[model samples]
Target: MNEQSPLIPTLPQGTPPEDLVPIGAPGGLDAAINPLGAELWFLRDRDGGHLLWNGNPDIWSGRAPILFPIVGRLRDDSYRHDGHVYRLPRHGFARHARFTPGAHDDHHALFRLEDNAETRAAYPFAFALTISYAITGNTLTIGAEVANRGDTPMPFSFGFHPALRWPLPQGGLRAAHHILFDRPEAPDIARLDSNGLLARSEPSPLEGQELRLRDALFEQDALIFPEVNSHAFTYTSPGGPAIRLQTENLPDLGIWTKPDADFICIEPWQGHADADDFSGDIFQKPGVIVLPPGEVWKASMSLTHERSA
Candidate 1:
């Protein structure tokens, strides 16, 4: 790679030339593409660092790069599609796949992932997934599209996991930060057992207090909330501004932070953690989406930061 070389792979002929510009640093595994935030706005790690969705490769973030957060199978890497079982790396392949930039101007670009042989062995269905990211000023709009490519029916689970930097005021700690979901009622927290399985569910109350990130809190895994009223959520600091994330076509939400870590992950999911008593049928899982042949499924989410009045 040279100073003028592109950071990502070269686009195919007839593809939009403007969309193939260098969005990140040269020769680095990951680059800081967007300048709106201090952190690298997207995640495109090393060659194999990306996730594979049904053989459709996608990238993952090692340093705060925007990437797809394919739930259902983030860690330990495996899932049971139909009555048969298959396995792959964590978070699926879509997160690691090198997407061809589409629908580009100066403010926004679209990245896409499609099905392939490697993905068919595990997922066993043809599908087209497109992610369109539009950046207008400080706001980013993320759009997801899933289309069935096979004649037979296909069932799967998917979600988004964008980790945002928690900006605390001077001399403040993460324990002093608060997160508010846009809903009138409380949420049900999905408990994870020692074996990283969904053990049970409980109520979540956001009473305007600080959130303590500890290992014991994740002992039961992530906090999964289903049947939420509002489509947006906010993370605010007592003495500073806040960031708001909104999503539709997402029936579930996950709030997670590394044990005693500095950042918090506000995840919008269409599916959830593995059940302790799964029947090996993908559709039997909660919040699973089943798409017919030639059918297209779409969902979108956005993130914006603003000062609190």
Candidate 2:
């Protein structure tokens, strides 16, 4: 992947004005990233085929919002920290906060978000979150670093919510697309109740290592896998190019889509939402990572386009 000087790349149609920055591989992938929430707005393949969802307002106006501070939702949209109660909405506020752009070139881009009055009010932590994207060959690598900049330890969660085109750009029926996990999974899947809180764990939905895709699967919302055995999976149809996603330092997975929608979200999460009965301090929440002060926690996920012959 030869690096090129920064230049203005073509923007996809209907792209909103969100200070989006363009980055592309030599002949593989092209992406437009927004500073607001450090979200990825557009992703296209070598032939200019859209590989990402378009953030259509009618269905779901979220292209690829970065989940932070919390992967899912809190019990009452609030948490306890140092005996005081703080409120944070579902998935945290990083998706709605603007990040400062760092060094960026044609093949890579970086954005950083730091603690402020607004964030501290809800999270009560001094921290810095950096998000980076690099495209090489037919693969796009996304990296994130969370640094605890305060005197006390901080507990938080992080996740990636990239919604790829349901049928993909490779050409196949939406129903034909399925996910092939890297290992045989055996644990029951977790579900969300009517309040979006973590509910009971149901039976496994996998047929060995393959999960057949369908609309009815997501009728109740996201299928949360709190204990998954695979670190990678392939989203593909019967033929044509397939999307291969790999994760590092992320333990959970969530597959979600609105019924009859044209996109599917493959989420890799470090933590999950509070359980339906959970009502304790933030540190006691399940799957939450407690970072020591002055330490950094990192996680990454990459997407590779596997072209068909």
Candidate 3:
């Protein structure tokens, strides 16, 4: 694992800030990504009513956001490192950090965010984070690679949050849709407390491979799976065909939606939030990925637009 991508991506001149790199397929799948957060904001499955959830103000402001450094809340929103205290907001800083366009072709776009003076003040680590999005036919694959550019190993957590249309613009009972898991899931999913910290586990509402989609299920908060047996699932709705996410190198899972929201987020994570009764050093926390100097930690998830069920 001695491969390193270029330091930055070259953006063609006259590219607008709102404009995204386009990835299209002859079968009618189209998508675009913005440099800000290296986020996938727009995804169209041929017919084009927008397959990804449109950011509704009352609901959520994110379409597909990448979570990094730390996957969830730290106790009191702060942590200690090397005998010094640091404050980092929930989900770390990757979502808010502006990534520089690395190298991109017609079907793939790579964006990189490296440690700088501003990041060092908060994170205190010299590392590089690169996110790449690729499209092949109706499939969109997102890849995140963390490189420890420093002499010491870098400890970090990573996650992916992708919200799809609940009922879809194609139209049905938001509850009519259901998530089809590749294998039978455990009867219980992990739970998070009011402060966004994880606590004791709870029995899951699911009995089989499919969990019927419903708004009421998230009345309290998110449904988290600390260790899911399968890493892939497909979302099916009568309003539209199935939208699938197949993952590699991602073991944790979360299903969440705001109160009465018309979207559901299927999140894949390499780590989770801090424990409710635990407060420890940042690098010692559970699920913290340690990358040796010059070594790379990478994960990829593929989103596919499937034919109607």
Please give the lDDT score for candidate 3.
0.82
Q: What's each prediction's TM-score?
A: 0.74, 0.95, 0.91
- lDDT for each residue of candidate 1 in 101-191, tens digit (9 for 90 to 100): 5565555556666677776776778887776665554456667788888998877666777665543323145565667766664545566
RMSD (Cα, Å) for all candidates, in order, is 8.8, 3.2, 6.5
**Among all candidates shown, the one with the greatest TM-score:** 2
CA lDDT of 225 in candidate 2?
Answer: 87
> Candidate 2 on 116-159: residue-level lDDT in tens?
98998889999999999999988999999999999999999999
In candidate 3, what are the lDDT values of residues 160-228, reduced to their tens digit? 999887776565667778988898888888888889999878888885787887777788788898879
User: Which TM-score value belongs to model 2?
Assistant: 0.95
Candidate 1 global lDDT? 0.56
TM for candidate 1 is 0.74
Candidates 1 and 3 compared by TM-score, better number: 3
